[model samples]
Target: MISDTAEYALRAVVWLVQTPDESQTTRQIAEGTRTPLDYQSKVLQLLAKSGITKSQRGTGGGIRLNVSPDGLTVLDVINAVDPIQRIHSCPLGLKEHGTCLCPMHRGLNDAVKTVEAAFKNTLVADLLKTRSKSVPLGIDLPLRAPRKPKQATA
Candidate 1:
């Protein structure tokens, strides 16, 4: 799973993408995205430092994206916020890890690679301009009811 920090950063980026001309205060991004204010501020700060976002500090001040949404890939956002180097490292730091995958660290690298590929391929602009190709969580199915069991070992 992607870090919650990355998820919040993407939400902030999407908010900026749709409102390219408006300076969204961190508070506004937090409230709009349902993220906690402190977390939003920290994420905003990281984005600012990374030059992905520009900040205005005085009256009527806030933040805005420096790059157009189309030019901003998910990798850009990922790097700007929660970097994934540790993700690629072996959990157990084993050398000679092979396709068989060390039992002590079975499939960990593959899991990280999957996340990297997903983030690398996605773009912030694509998020703003499109409907999700798959059903979003809490949308396609009932949220509260127990899932029905497979019938009779069909």
Candidate 2:
């Protein structure tokens, strides 16, 4: 699973893709993605450092995606923030442990590989295109109706 920072980064990237030509300030990006501005700024810096996005300073300066959404994968954003670490060998570091892992660890490692491959293959543009129309990026408050209070019986 990805971290909160990764989630925020993905949201920011998707928001940028929605307006590909326009650069957005951290404040605007945070507001648009409903992410915390402070955390979002750090995530933005990581994205910039990873070369997934470009940043500028001073007036009219902002951040924008450096690559096309179609070419960028969800794994890119995740790696920029919290990389998915695949277990290549036995985690216990047993001296007698051979190249083959125990059934349990092997299955876990296989699952990780599967998830990694899925994320790596999923493009940001594809995510946007395949997202539910009413709840893009899984952020639609209106989809859930507010609970009604019950009146006390007399």
Candidate 3:
């Protein structure tokens, strides 16, 4: 299973691409996408560290995609952040001595391959364009102002 942080990172990248505005700070990115500010902030940092997204510090500092969305595949982001090893190695982490997928992971291999293929084929830009129709699993909210926090802790 993919971590929510990884999912949010992918969403952030797509949202950033759909309507780019220079570079978006963590707050701005989370606010517009209606995601948790703190969680989004952490994901941004991870993305920056992975080289999929770049970040600047202090004033005028924000985040942006390192590569053009059109040129970046979903798998690239997935591998960079929350890579799902495709299981070709081994479910039991066995040494390289199998003729094919072990019986325990036979059908699973095909599923993993299908998922890998889908991720490999999907480009960020391509996914963003589908916004008007269906929302991606990673992002559930529409672009808009983030909900304002309560003035008092009460």
Candidate 4:
């Protein structure tokens, strides 16, 4: 499972990719991504620190993507906020066991690898193309009511 911060980071990145306009203020980014302004600001700062996004100050300045959406992977965004930690050593801390993991841990680590692979292969651009119109990035936006069919004149 990923952290809320990571989720917010991903949403913010995806929103930026989708918009691809001028730099956006923290408030705008938070509103577009449906994340809390306070928390989103922190997430944006972390992103800027990681070089995933660039932050500007003063007039005509805000935040924008530093890396191209096509070049940026989901893993990159996730790592910016909450890196997917891998099991490197035995949890039991057995000297004889050394760095080797038990069968259970081995399986868990393998699963982690699988997840990493999926994230690595997924790009923000790809997500934009395949995202559901019903719920973008799992954030449910207000849907418009269906229009009534027009009747033929007599």
Winner of 1 and 2 under TM-score? 2
Whose lDDT is higher: candidate 2's or candidate 4's?
A: 4
lDDT of 4 by residue, 1-77 (tens): 87899999998987766545567899999998889999999999999999988888999888887778777899999
lDDT of 3 by residue, 1-154 (tens): 5677668877787777654446788887897767899998877877888877877788876777666776788888877767776556566666763546676687787787788899899987677566555676455433332222237765
Q: Which residue segments of model 4 deviate by more than 4 Å? A: 131-154
lDDT of 2 at 49: 98
TM-score to native of every candidate shown: 0.73, 0.83, 0.73, 0.83
Q: List candidate 2 segments past 4 Å from native.
A: 138-154
Error of 1 at 42 (Å): 0.5
TM-score of 4: 0.83
Residue pairs with backbone overlap in model 4: none
Best by lDDT: 4
Report the error of model 3 at residue 45, Å.
Answer: 1.6
Taken over the whole model, the C-alpha lDDT of each candidate is 0.71, 0.80, 0.71, 0.82
Q: Per-residue lDDT tens digits of candidate 1, residues 8-92?
A: 8877876665556667788888887789999999999999899888889888778887776666789889878988763344555
lDDT of 1 at 123: 69
- Of the two candidates 3 and 4, the one with more favorable lDDT, higher being better, is 4
lDDT by residue (14-121, candidate 2, tens digit) is: 887766555789999999889899999999999999998888898867887887777789998899988988777778987566657888888888998999899999
